[model samples]
Target: MRGTPLRGAIYGLLAAAIWGGMYVVSDVVLKVIPPFTLLTIRLILGAVVLLVIRWRTA
Candidate 1:
């Protein structure tokens, strides 16, 4: 597909940034949120994000 490389690079960068920030964010968030509750919230948000991306691509 056209611009596939550019899209891939952008996605890679975004993933990397998220991964890098996750630890810092989680540390502060965990103080306010319980572990399991935080996990569930993350899972739900991730699923919603993936579904939106899939729907947009399709």
Candidate 2:
């Protein structure tokens, strides 16, 4: 009950942290991998992740 007020702030910090990590990883990956290839990989990975999440929920 006491933590209710802090939920939004916590989620905001988590989102920032996730995005910062992605930026660092993308910077390193793009040096060796082409942009289109990276985009394809990200799309595939996102699809797999979403599928797994959906399967689990069902």
Candidate 3:
């Protein structure tokens, strides 16, 4: 699309923000929870969030 540059910039910023949040939250959770369990929780949470977004758009 013609908006590729703008799209890329927005996605890059979004990725940075997401990873920053991920690091903070995982650090907190890892103090008590195991890595695998944390991963499952993160993945499921991401999936549910994405599905909700998709449903709204569609």
lDDT tens digits, residue span 1-58, model 2: 5667589899899999999899889899999999999999989999999999999999
TM-score of candidate 1 on Cα atoms, chains taken together = 0.71
- Superposed Cα deviation of residue 39, candidate 1 (Å): 0.9
Q: What would the per-residue lDDT of candidate 1 be over residues 8-57, giving only the tens digit for each residue? A: 99999999999999999999999999999999998999999999999999
Off by over 4 Å in 1: 53-58
lDDT of each: 0.96, 0.94, 0.91
* Per-model TM against the reference: 0.71, 0.68, 0.57
Flag regions of model 3 displaced more than 4 Å: 1-18
Instruction: Enumerate residue pairs that collide in model 3.
Output: none
Residue 54 of model 3: what lDDT? 100
TM-score of 2: 0.68
Q: Write the residue-wise lDDT of candidate 3 on 1-58 in tens digits.
A: 5678889999999999998898788788899999999889889998999999999999
